[model samples]
Target chain A: MQHSDYVELTSTRLNPHVDPALTVWGWEVPVYLFMGGLVAGLLFLYSVVVLLRREERYPTVAKTVPLLATPLLGIGLFFLFLDLEFKAHVFRFYTSFQFYSPMSWGSWILLVVFGVGGVQFLYTLAELEPFRKTAIGKWSVWGLFKKISGNTRRKLAWWTLILGIALGIYTGLLLASLTARPMWNSALVGPMFLISGLSAGTALTMLLARARAERDILVRFDLLLVFMELAVILMWVGAMAHGSEAGLEAAHQILGGAYTAVFWSLVVVAGLIVPAVLEVQSLRGKWPHTVVAPALILVGGLVLRLVMVQAGQSFGYGA
Target chain B: MTRTAHKYGMVVDTIACVGCSACTLACRSENEVPEGLSRRWVNQETRGSFPDLKMKIWSESCQHCENAPCVKNCPTGASFIDDFTGTVQVERDLCTGCKACMASCPYDARYIHPTGYVDKCTLCHHRITGGLETACETVCPTSAIVVGDLNDPGSEISQLLRKRKFEQRRTAAGTRPKFFLLV
Candidate 1:
């Protein structure tokens, strides 16, 4: 007689959120990553504008955006803090640093970004007419701000640019370094995330820029960033597809697996392609400029992080 | 010549295990593992058809790898290798509870303790350091579980490996796991 053979597991290994699948990270992490990317993009754009001596040409990019960096980063850090299981012990991140830990590198990099970005904000504030008329702006620090010449601003810009790039890459490296999640195992994720951030930053700048020339320049730059983002994303998925069994499974998750519809609809079509087409139309003088395109890019940027973070955690070694 | 330090590990005889889960209970009691969580558990696998069927049962827990990804990924030096015994251990106070170690572990061996720290099988570090066997090894009715120093030639685990054909879980992960399962 023929019989069926089966394997059964019976034990008390009931660890919540970890047994059947890893669900340790939730929405908090993606939100934190999104905000971090946004700040990184803003800082990078601000630094580039200053370094190229385009402050006169792109005043909003050079002045207004840097002021947003410190507050945006603070929001991101708050969400990161919320994700920590031990909230009181959060300060321990700074006490000792593990060289191999991407989180460690990210934490330290965030601190440096904050310091540099804060200084840049102060300089920007000192130069603003509305702020200069305020009481606090009349402080003796105004003397130091006045002493900051074009050369010092350029040096600061260089530092901000390097730090911004580091921060942007670090956001992606944070997930890429975790080899346990096969979905994030590719080396291309860092550059992909960096490009995505740059695209988001460009979109935000385009929305905020008052001058048509600034908007035109950002529209073209964002178009290039969006294309780069799509290419890197494709390369990442292709690399995963060609990787190990688990890697293939990870690739399948986004390609045609559970995340297929959302990844394609929300992230790819609406977030990237739609925004690209809109920007292209604007460039051609066929579509009137509005907040819709840049707004979509920002939304897409957030959805990308949300999808990647959730999908990466859902599958691993055995899955 | 300098003497190599003791590398504590475990060996389980799959054929000898009866799947009673005594080891799992013993571990929970010994480690005081929190509710709804366990440091160790039993798994039963049955394969083949009818008269040709074969069944194997074994207990599982942290592999305590020599190249543990959890230790490497911990940002705060919280997850670390115990110097006295070459086994992985977590410094509870140092852990920020970031869960990076949780995501990095291929074995899924760690869990965030209810008290806001990452906890896992220390191989009964307290008992082993006191010159006693792990609670699971001590309480296993079939004597299927063996815990000892892999570095010591005369140790039970070393002799078992020498005399028996064995396999490890997910060697492809390149973690160099110390947990062994005798075939």
Candidate 2:
């Protein structure tokens, strides 16, 4: 018996462009992007708390985030370093910065965050008596260093404030810089990445937060970030759907094409709406599970980058 | 910042292209473009119904744009225009094989090599600098590929372009590409 599944098409044109496919970037890019966004989110959240009120003790929150963030960033950067095909010539990135290249800006920006953020964050930590009594504190002179004053901490907070936002925005700008990919080509990527990072960062902070009050703050803040993320993503998709031929096709890829299932199931349901709803329920005291939203947010964050990177590369203008 | 001395360009007579794969083969052998990846190839656009089919074969390669995205967006100064000829060239040593140029390039002309650096058609820089044409131009059976200086008014490319109605691929990108297809 012959199978009776005949796919009918109104138009079947054999129009092939150069290369006609995208297999250049691999898993490393999405992983790097996720890590970069996560670190940026962590720094930004910590800085925001310090900026809001440097004196108020939010013990289970970002006060100890530096310990996690500094190392998390290092692991993220290690992935990037490993992904470099010619690792020996990585120094060339630092030789001369191109104004036109976001990668150039990113290299310098990552350097500043790693150097200044890492040092100051560790210094901020070592001043605590528990850390001061540790082997790491005794092994290093950084512990002996004077704890920064309120004024200095405030100033450091401001610096991290600016740097953290830049790092958050840079993650999106990295993709947004490529004009060829319709999914990546948008001003919305900036805010989208920033908000998503904040949401993910808040989720992470909530996970680490042992204090009920701290978790409450993180949960509420993450809810706001989730709403903003949802808005930014919708705006991005809507703009693309209305923008150009290539952009429309790209929207289709997510809305109801190759990436349709992932986009809806993972990004929309799992990443955005579900997290927001969970946070909302937790906020209303209807659900005590504060851990669920943040965990889903982290998973969503990874999937967002992965699906976009995959879809954007597949969507081309000329083809 | 110093500018190049001349502007290099290419014009392919698509009406004459036989889709022989000769140019792609010549480019591979001339440039030693590894085993799998190619520096240059032909794109066939087939349209209309069967027996009424219209096919336009475009011999595609690096466009050598005046405002090249690859040149602008490359993190390292690996992908750059040659000062003498104005043809975009790569300094393999400077390339991190980051593939930024590959992603930025709309033409998909750049590729990552096994040596951990990007490689692309230099328009046969060695030969062109020596007052000879590109190997693709030299071996093109129909003389479909013409390479010359676009800046020189007396140049053959400028003269042909001035005489004929030509079109460029993806002009909307605003790259100000040097490749021309005689209409």
DockQ leader: 1
For residues B14-42, what per-residue lDDT tens digits would candidate 2 score against the true structure?
Answer: 78987787888888898887777778878
- Residues A5-47, model 1: lDDT tens digits: 4444444466897877789999999998888888888988988
Against the true structure, candidate 2 has what lDDT?
0.81
Give the interface RMSD values of the models in order: 2.5, 7.4
Q: Go through the candidates in order and give each one's DockQ.
A: 0.63, 0.41
Question: Candidate 2, which segments miss by more than 4 Å at Cα?
Answer: A1-20, A54-56, A148-151, B1-3
> Candidate 2 residues A1-319, lDDT tens each?
1223222222111122224566677788888888888888888877778778843568644467766777888888888888787889999999989888889999999998987677667676766678778787776666344445333666877878888889889889988988777789899997898888877777888888887777888888888888888888989999999988878888999878999999889988998899888888877889886577889999999999999888888767654
| Fnat of every candidate, listed in order | 0.76, 0.43
Q: Tally clashing residue pairs in candidate 2.
A: 0
